[model samples]
Target: MQTPEQVAAAFDLLADQHDAMRWDLALSEFDASVLASLEGIATANVASSALFLAGGSGREALSFVMHGWKCDLVELSRRMLELAECRLHKFDLRIVESEAARYLADTTEKYDFISMVGELVGYVQEPRSILRAAALRLRPDGLIAVTWVDSSSLAATRQTEEQGVVALVERDDLEIRAWTCETMQKYVDAARLTVVLRSGRMAESPRRFWILRKEM
Candidate 1:
């Protein structure tokens, strides 16, 4: 299992090529899905604040900042955060270089909108705990847009399972934990979050996208 720092190192190695991939929609389904979901959240309620966890290269934060939302982006990789700063320097974005879990633990401020997309959850050691922590930082009516990896979807060389949690090893430096939709929903329930929007329930895809609201 790779620690958060190890994962950050792996991402740092990919930083040079990451921004290019983000700009190309055809190659970036994750960005497209997240942006489309953001539009939905924007239409229903005009969110004034947003927090992006594991936000890479400022593409998502860029959209929120452009619309005048006070944006704070927390990224683990130094290289990635540097690139994000270059893109977001014009805006008053609070870009921080810290692991998402630690930031959530230390920050007392709450947000109206929070996004934990990319491999934020999968790369973490305690996925459920992180989700619960994010929920605690959300305002009552706030929305959380996130994505999770499906355990069965990866073509990993070796895999391990324990109590429904699966660790997928694709390469020496590339390892991610995954969970089934049912298992992930269980985590959401435990966190007191309700899923308002789900991309799909099918197991065909490796990643699952969801928009959650703190349960009243």
Candidate 2:
């Protein structure tokens, strides 16, 4: 319900706070679950493949790569990219200072893995559009990971409107468009992908994460 720019600015500040929430065990549950659920794909196989992280500002997913997996991140901010680089300097990470959906939709490039995290999912009106688009960027048998807010989750009940930045979000019914695990399935089902993994609701904030693989 907040302006995209306002939300981005607020998150940028939070990124500086400690990034504690980003790496929380519950936070990684979505990622960990998706990784575990995929039985056909070898863990190392997906990890070693090329990855596109739409809306990967601040490079939280980059840590996933350096710490365990191996993949590149796509972000929309130069400043965020710089910070990500600083934190993930040891890996073979590459970045693009543009929106992930924009890049995948406009370019001929394809990846073996794609992670649509935080800002991208947290702010889109059509989160599925990004997932469908990301699916296009994947080669056959490639995997796409998507995370988004679960609008129906009771988690939001405790988050008073006053907690976010002042006027941080708009009060439009548009928030109803948020994608939860239940609804997100429709998107993946509609897309030309096979749902391989899915997870959500690890914390008070209800966010859904899905892992899909392009059919062979």
Candidate 3:
């Protein structure tokens, strides 16, 4: 299991070319649909608040910010936040320098929407704890969008069972955890969240994108 420091260091090294590399841009594009569907849903004339956990360079969070959602982006890498600050300096959103799980656990502020995309769950050692903390910080009717490494993939399943970590076929040096569908359901149930949406073309990708909400 990769420690937070190790994960942060890995991301810090990628901060400069992160945006240009266009890593996970497809997932970001898919995330915008949720933002579009939720537009103008804030109560009492207040803008809907959205939290971006492990949002790198604020790229995916841009959709939420541009949609007029009040946004907070939490990232562990100093270099990433520096670039995020530069790109989002004119915006009103808060860019926090903290681990996602710690920020979720510590924040008193609740959000209408929380995004843990960019494979944040898969990168972490304790995804269940992260999910639980994020769920606790959500307002009623709030939603969380996240991604996971699907153990349905043969490579992920075999590697995860044998080596304890699955290496990304696209970036072999980057190792991550994978979750089976049943395990993911158990985690979500433990967090008291219901799956609102689960999407991915498993034939094309080993990652699954999910949207979760508290039982209302």
Q: Report lDDT (CA) for all predictions.
A: 0.83, 0.57, 0.75
Error of 2 at 5 (Å): 4.4
Scanning candidate 3 in windows of ten residues, the lowest lDDT window is 36-45
Clashes of each: 0, 4, 0
Q: Which stretches of candidate 3 lie over 4 Å from their true place?
A: 23-46, 156-173
lDDT of candidate 1? 0.83
Better of 1 and 3 by lDDT: 1
Clashing pairs in 2: 1-169, 1-170, 2-169, 2-170
Q: Which RMSD does model 1 reach against the true structure?
A: 2.1
**Alpha-carbon RMSD, candidate 2:** 6.3
* Per-residue lDDT of model 1, residues 59-136, tens digit only: 777668877888899998999999998888999799989999999999998999998978588888888899999999
Off by over 4 Å in 1: 28-30, 155-161, 200-204
**Tens-place lDDT digits, model 2, residues 20-108:** 44433354565556444432343456355566564334344544565455556766544566666776677766666666656777778
The most accurate candidate by lDDT is 1
Give residue 67's lDDT in candidate 2 (0 to 100). 43
